[model samples]
Structure formats: C-alpha cells, structure tokens
Target: MNGTLIFDGGCGFCTRSRNLLTRLDRHGRVGTVPFQEDGVEERTGLRPDQLAASVWWLDADGGRCGGAEAVNSALSAALGTRLPLLVYRLPGMGRLQEAVYRWVAANRYRFPGVTPWCQQHPAGCRPA
Candidate 1:
C-alpha cells in the first residue's frame, strides 16, 4: 500500500473527510482504517489515547505522521502531487495548518453530520 490513514470512526466530520479522501484516491494508493477497529493499536504501535487524539498516516517505508502532517501526506499521495506536502512544510504554514486542524477537531461534533448523529446516538459518538 502507498499509505494507510487511521482516523476516528466515531467522528462524523472525520468520516466525511475520509469519504472525500476516498474519492480523491483514484489510484487506490491510500487506505483508511478507523482507530476504533480491533488490532489497530497493535498494528500501529500507538496507544488508544494517542490514536483517538489525531488522524495518523503510516507510510510504506515505516514512517508515521499525525494530525495536519498526516493529512498533507495523504492528500499528496491521493492526488499524486507534492503540493500539499510542500505547502504544509513551509515555515509558518505548518504551524497554521496544525492550529486549524486542532480547531476543527476540537469542534467537530458541532458540524452538521456530527451534531445530528451525536444527538441521536450519544454513546456512539466521541466527545467534541
């Protein structure tokens, strides 16, 4: 596999993002797995708390990156371009991107799909 992305399955926003990633992955170079799945921790060598904290990308060469960096890596691979990765690595841009990602992740359940789903199925959704 070109790369593997691990994300929060219980998060609606994350799920929607994954769907978009799926569409962008025309060559199927990236694969996604919800962190909630069994064996994920063992496979990734990450603890449950760590997995739940951010989206993670595991590269083919045994490299791991999380949060906005993970997103950059996944997008770069899916679109078959280095633009996203390069942009993310720019001095201040990386910090800005990470801040935005954290903001979105913190308020994820306030979004459309998440709010409704969490309202109906509180136990199934992770806290925002």
Candidate 2:
C-alpha cells in the first residue's frame, strides 16, 4: 500500500467506514491502522487529540494529510479516481465537509455496529 489510513479503533463509524472504503478501494492503495496501534504517533507525528479528532492518511514517504482532505485523498487513490477528490475540493464545500466529519467523529460511538469491546472502554472512546 502507498498510504496508511490512520483512524480511531474505538469508533464504530470509523471502523465501518474504513471497511466500506476498503471494499470500494479495488486498487488497494491504502492500508488501515488504528490510532492506538503501537508507534502510530511516532510514525504519523500526530498527537492523541489530533488523531482522535479526524482520520489521517500517511504517504509512503511519511507525508501526512488529515481530516476530510485525508479521507477524500485516500478514497481517490484507492479507487484510482478523481471525482471524489474533486467533489471534496469544490468551492465553498470544505467547511461543510469538515463540519460533517467532525460531527460524525465526535458522535461515532452512538451509532450502531459498535463492537462490545469498543464500548467496554468508555474512557478510551472519543468524545461521545
């Protein structure tokens, strides 16, 4: 994989979304890793708060992109398409996209599909 998709392991929405994206990603350009994985912070240069707030993408050379932009770029690369990336960059859309991402991320645990394990660690979970 050329990119590593760093996301929250404790989030139902994030895990489900990553799975959905993986299936959509026929090109298999990216690999998924939870923010809690060993050495993740060292590898991605991300603080815990930063990792908790958004999904992030790390390039082979260690270049990093976070939040909605990271999501769009990872999807685009994985599918070998530009339309998704283009849509994410449409004029006046960035703010709205980021807002939605933030909302979903903050409230991910409330959604269904959350594993029992993820729910067990309330303190480990992101802002509910």
Candidate 3:
C-alpha cells in the first residue's frame, strides 16, 4: 500500500505509457489502474475530476498528487529515479510543468493514445 499509480486507461497514450513504465520498472512497483473502471472510485475514494484531470498518485499515507508530480512519484517508486524530482523543484519549474500537463490532458485526444471515437464517447470506452 505504498501508493497507487492511476492513469486514464481509456486514453491510448496513457495505456502505452503504462506499458512502458511496467517494462522499465525493475522493482515491479509501477502498479496502476484506470479510474474509469468499475469499483475504482469506491475503492480509491477519488473524485471524478481527480481522475479525469490528470494522472495521479495516491500515496500510502493518503496524500494525493497529480500530473507531473504523479509522474515524478511513479518513477521514483518504480525505478528509484531522483532527477525529475530534483529538476521539478527548481524555481518556476513546478508551475510551468503543471500547466503543460493540464494542456496535454485537455488535448489528449490528439495524441497517439486516443481515437476519435473514444474521445467522442468516453463513457463507453472504460474497462469493463
């Protein structure tokens, strides 16, 4: 219960990214689930927007972090990476990175992970 890595399993890019992280994670620590799946919200107690807005990390202690911070956490937990954690803390990097992440989330359909149909009807595309 160290933490739970969450992603938009409905997104094509998110699915691919999860696959890559699973491969790179030598410790097998990159456990993830898409919030759109059944029972996920009840299980995680995360609000809907928390899942839709960005990738998230639900810490073992119940702390929540999303977007770039979540990425940093996943890497750190799964691969013990420290560089991104360090770089993100520099002066204005956090705010800038978060804004960029929001933009990417908003435009995810244009990326490789989503199809036009899925984007059009997100309700039907989640895991069964």
Quote each prediction's TM-score: 0.86, 0.83, 0.80
lDDT score for residue 116 of model 2: 34
Q: List the candidate numbers ranked by lDDT, top first.
A: 1, 2, 3
Off by over 4 Å in 3: 114-128
Candidate 3's residue-wise lDDT over 71-110, tens digit each? Answer: 8777777776667778888899989989998888898757
Model 1 lDDT at residue 6: 93
**In lDDT terms, how accurate is model 1?**
0.85
**Ranked candidates, highest TM-score first:** 1, 2, 3
Please write out the lDDT profile of model 1 over residues 31-110, one tens digit for every residue. 98878776888999999999988999999999999999999999998999989999998889999999999998889767
Q: Which candidate would rank higher by TM-score, 1 or 3? A: 1
Better of 1 and 2 by lDDT: 1
lDDT of 2 by residue, 1-128 (tens): 36889888877768778778889878778888878666777877889889878889887777888888888878877888777779988997877888888787778878876553245555544433
Worst 10 residues of 2 by lDDT: 116-125
TM-score of 1: 0.86
Off by over 4 Å in 1: 114-128
